[model samples]
Target: MSKQPASYRPRHAVILAHPNPASFNGLVADAYCDAVRACGHEAIVRDLYALGFDPLLREHERPGTEGFRLSPDVDAELDILRGSDVFILVYPIWFGMPPAMMKGYVDRVLGAGVTSAQVQHRTAETVLRGKRLVGITSSGASKAWLNEQDQMDSLRQLFGRYLLHAFGMKAYEDLHFGETIEGLDQDYVDANLAQVGDRARAICAAIASDRAQGQAVPPAA
Candidate 1:
């Protein structure tokens, strides 16, 4: 267990994109939070739908545009985000992609306060730099079919590679739970959730290892 001294434990921001609180995506987020908490860490679960987070990107807010600044809402979110180490996004996929809300979060939050030139030149000081990203996506379709269409590949390129590179994140992974329907199979759901917990544990372990290594290494003179 993490013993969780104030500001001492690793913080995980679990971004949940499901409108339905009872959704599989929600469950996945829950399992992740539970597992991390069990490990003595903190979990900040943000349900975008419930929070009524605006996903709209204003034209004036674009980095290159004049009078560019983070919105009050975005600032609030960032206040909640600052000091967080890991980010986990849980959403349901439609048409082989995340919904507008999910994309909006990335555009408005993850992609905020940075210039296009910075991204292209890798000059932006990304707040997410050296952090970890875990994406959990649920779909009604089969993984094989999605792969045949190269949808997952495209998503990986967009999320796994581009997003990580743009944000300077140390690592990224997306776990897809497919064939998820209204009436889910209990056994299958349990198994998938177990996997989610396992992943959470692994992340906690990795975070601990990273902290240990950082402490062990001496700063240069």
Candidate 2:
């Protein structure tokens, strides 16, 4: 009798919302997953655009509806997220915000399958609670200019902090690369990818420490 391979319980999830397979966002996603695996931890990748994911939220599917339900896609996404402690989002910022695809993912997947109907429902159950969020985003504008205009801070507040607080996640970290327009320099790309790899290693180390200490993180509100 042949022995089956050991089960894989993914610890990190890398989600990409880039339309082009060869885009920088795709490269970042690949680098992240590879780095996580190199650190001896499992990581799952989800390419929303490549999978033709539906970004629309139908009226009937609204939360607390008479018959609120999640579509098969959302269910699958949630299932993947359930086992993950770290979620890394890779995308290109457009018009000072994440692309529509990423926004849709936030609504359909990160929102979780079901939420309590009443606002201020202090005890609502959420699968994403205690998880950590990291973001790798690129933009056509320069990073200094964006920071000068307070756009980066805006994004950190609106996307990272807001999501962290809303979902009860543990932490939020965002890294941005600017001047990513056409004819971008290869050196810039390499530098950013190196940083991405470094971040993955750091996160993996932290997760390992938590596991070793038998930390119990959950039901955060």
Cα lDDT of candidate 1 equals 0.87
Give TM-scores for every candidate, taking all chains together and pairing residue i with residue i: 0.93, 0.87
Query: Candidate 1 lDDT, tens digit per residue, 104-143?
Result: 9998988887888777876667557778998889899988
Give the clashing pairs for model 2.
none
Which regions in candidate 1 have their CA more than 4 angstroms from the true location?
Answer: 1-7, 217-221
lDDT of 2: 0.81
What C-alpha lDDT values do all the predictions have? Answer: 0.87, 0.81
Give me the candidate number with maximum TM-score.
Answer: 1
In model 2, which regions exceed 4 Å deviation? Answer: 1-10, 113-124, 215-221
User: How close to the true structure is residue 159 of candidate 2, measured as C-alpha lDDT?
Assistant: 90
* Superposed Cα deviation of residue 70, candidate 1 (Å): 1.4
RMSD of 2: 5.7
